[model samples]
Target: MNNPHQNARMTPLGRAEMVRRIVEEQRPVAEAAAGFGISRRTARKWLARWRAEGAVGP
Candidate 1:
């Protein structure tokens, strides 16, 4: 079977870490975003989702 996350740049753990760095560590959105190799906008999207719905967002 083809694995969907095989070629993916980010995984579930990566997302959790990204959010953790931004929230728990209080890292700047831009800095954390860059560290994760994603754009600040994308980071904000996840941050917003994290704020709104948390890890189990739909």
Candidate 2:
């Protein structure tokens, strides 16, 4: 599978936005990942980072 993280190069704020839209706003991670053109695993990693730093990681 293609690595979205390697291609997108999303910043910390962009990653945080994706995670918040999925986890906090009750959106689907798969759907969000699709929108962002990233893998679910990448999305989940950003979510974990957000949880760890309270919205400050990439």
Off by over 4 Å in 1: 1-7
Candidate 1 lDDT, 1-58, residue by residue in tens: 1233577667767877899998999999999999989989988987887788878431
Per-candidate TM vs. native? 0.79, 0.73
| Alpha carbon deviation, residue 37, candidate 1 (Å) | 0.5
Where is the poorest 10-residue window by lDDT in model 2? 1-10
Q: What is candidate 2's lDDT per residue for 1-58, written digit by digit as tens? A: 1234665667666776798788778999899888888899989888777777775554
lDDT of each: 0.79, 0.76
- Model 2, which residues run further than 4 Å from truth? 1-8
Q: Ten residues in a row with the worst lDDT in model 1?
A: 1-10
Q: What is the TM-score (0 to 1) of candidate 1?
A: 0.79
